[model samples]
Target: MEFDLSWPVLWNGLFWPLIRLTFFISVGLLVGNLIESLQWTRYAAKLADPLARRARLGDISAASFTMAFFSGITANTMLSEAHEKGEISDRELILSNLFNSLPTYFLHLPTIFFIAAPFIGSAAAVYVGLTAFAAIIRTMAIVFSGKFLLPPIKEGCLPCRLDEMEKKRDTKSALQKTWARFKKRLPKVLYLTCPIYTLFFVFKQIGMFAWLQGFMSGSASFFTFLPPEALGIVVFHMAAEFTAGLAAAGAMISDTSLTQTQVILALMLGNVLSSPMRAFRHQFPYYAGIFRPRMAFKLILYNQVTRGLTIALVGTAYALLMT
Candidate 1:
């Protein structure tokens, strides 16, 4: 066997995907950004104060819950400050963080859908759809839990500086703002997505995923719930992030004769299993650093359990329906 090397990585895996991704992402980002700027105002946090109040959170917590939509760190920092000030309790902290789940998911939905629609194709909708539904369920659970499990606030919420709070507004016209956001987000999406897409394709071409498939077959009984073809995707998800896992799932979707249901089930299953590790790696440290250790641990635990259950519920429904 002769060794070959000459922009193989660039031409072989990256070229078409780069071209396809560039066009789709450029257009999608523009459209998605415009929609975000024009349609949804950041005042959702202020607007959601009533719902948050019903859920037993005070003004400060509700405000933080709203801030979560734009920036989780901002939301979380506010939560920490409120916690330090005794405005919210441990229970409120846990519930509020969970309530922010939907917004946090929404925060990235545009980016994920726009990027995925092209890279992952038709399957992108299904993959994003299931998670969105799951996020919705988790949000519902938080609301109900807050209403039933926690007591409603009697004392007025702290006098958070609502007057000083500001929403991000661009001075430019919608088109200019869209163009600016599109340009800003485009490189970031491509930087993350392009390399992952390319690497996954190269790995597939060289048969890394094939080995994973073969490896999983011996233990197929372990994943009896998932279709045989999806085992590789599950493995990839368990080992890496959604980018690699979805990339693998997308390849199967585009190349193999796998049906949409199979792809959805596979990706969902991967999502179900992989979330805990992600929580540990990302959520755990961030929360611990910001919140007290025990509080962080509890918050992370609640979120992981809630998220896992939500995904599992969706996956079960899909599996049963498919069967």
Candidate 2:
């Protein structure tokens, strides 16, 4: 058996996508860190205070919600400390952590949007918007759960001292921190991205994607709503990092056969399917380090299940409206 490889095809597949994504990732991370360093997201917590009150989240949980916009670990740390001190019950801790989902999503929104836009173009807007919507849904669900499952709290929920944190912001410091973070993060992102893009390119050249689509045709009933090429996107999303899925989507976006709606829907579907495994792999250690191992697993399970269902519901609505 012989294999034919062309430099021009490989170059087009790999070079352009890598360069574009790298540029976007770098700019996105720098700007994102800068914005975060400026402490602008503190306002999110303020706006959420009313909801927090309605849900009867106490001072520590409210403070942690504010802190989550800056550092999830720090916010979670606060909850863990409170749990240790017996300031809050186990149910309240879990519910409060779940309620922070919106702030956490917004904290990462800039980076996610910028990184996605370069590859998926306008579809990024639709996809990110849907995910944002799903985050809102999850947060609302948590709020309702807290209201029903937990007892009412005292009248006073100590306001977060975000203003104190905001007063310390310095543009020079923000820039320096952004630069340092960009330097540390960009290389690692590219390290994963380059190899994945190259491998995806090779898979494309070998007609593996087509074969996989055909092979999975028997199972296509499950995804009758999506085109066969969409299986490639979902597979890449589940098997590799998000960039791999974006690379696959980027490659397919140019193909005249696939409509923009189909591509967007595919990305949404991939997100719904991939989030569980991704959350488990990435969030387990962080959660476990802060909470007990069993609690960490429970948190991960709940987060993924909530995220998946919300995204699936939102995606279904989108598919119905668009298609």
Candidate 3:
């Protein structure tokens, strides 16, 4: 079983995708930063304050939650600073981070949707929409928990310090801030994206994904709920980047045999299976840098567990109702 390891095959597969993904991701980041620099997210934060207050979180924690919509790093940093100052307890610190997850998911929503749209068409919307729904559910659960478990705050105003956030807003024009952010973020994005994308392309050209699809087919009894072709989507998802799954699902979209619901279920299942590893690999380091290693691990554990359960619940309900 020979495969094309030729330069042309490698170049064609890697070049165009890397270009498209880079462009879309850059635009997404720029949009996110512009919204932040322009203070557009302030309104969202204002609206979320009622929810934060109901959860009995103090102004500092609520402010961190607001910061999350634009930059999760900054938001977590705020929480870490507050924790260090004893402005909030350990439990509040963790709960605040978890509460911010909904916005955190949204920080990359544009990138994910734009990337998936080209590959999976309308199903991209469905898949992203479902994941966003799961994020909302998880956040709501955190809010409910906070309401019951955490004591009330006597802070004069929940959104008062929200005005303090304006001090950090960029003075430059939106376009200038967007360009600066693009320059700063693009290199880091490409550093990781280039090697990983090239390796996945090589794997695809070399039949790695095909072999996994065969394995999934052989193990079909276990995943009885999903269609056979849909197994390839799950395989690609688990094997490589989320785009790999979209690519597989995209290919399957043209096949008249499979329904859109089946493709969505496969995506949801792939997301459920793949999220834990991704969190541990990508999130742990960042969290550790901000908080202690122990704290970071706790946050990651809570995040992955809660995320998995909520997404699974949404998937199960979707399957029952739609399929």
lDDT: which candidate is best? 3
lDDT of all predictions: 0.69, 0.72, 0.75
> Mind giving the per-residue lDDT tens digits that candidate 2 earns over 1-323?
33456677656766766676556545545544554556543554466677887787876677678777876766775676568669789899889888888989999999999998998898889889989999999988988888889888765434444646646567788888768866775566566556655665666577775565444433434887777788777777655668888888988987755777777777777777667655764455445545676887888887888888998899889888985
Off by over 4 Å in 2: 1-47, 157-221
Clashes of each: 0, 0, 0
Residues 73-150 of candidate 3: C-alpha lDDT, one tens digit per residue: 667756765586687899999899899999999999999999999988898898899999999998899889998889
Between candidates 1 and 3, which one is better according to lDDT? Answer: 3
Looking at model 2, the pairs that clash are none
TM-scores of the candidates are 0.66, 0.67, 0.69
Q: After superposing candidate 3 on the true structure, give the runs of residues whose Cα lies further than 4 Å from its correct spot.
A: 1-47, 155-221
Q: Give the Cα error of residue 13 in candidate 2, in Å.
A: 27
Q: 61-127 in candidate 1: lDDT tens per residue?
A: 6766666777776577566655766867888888888989998999999998887676568878877
The residue pairs that clash in candidate 3, if any, are none
Model number with the top TM-score: 3
* Cα misplacement distance, residue 58 of candidate 2 (Å): 0.8
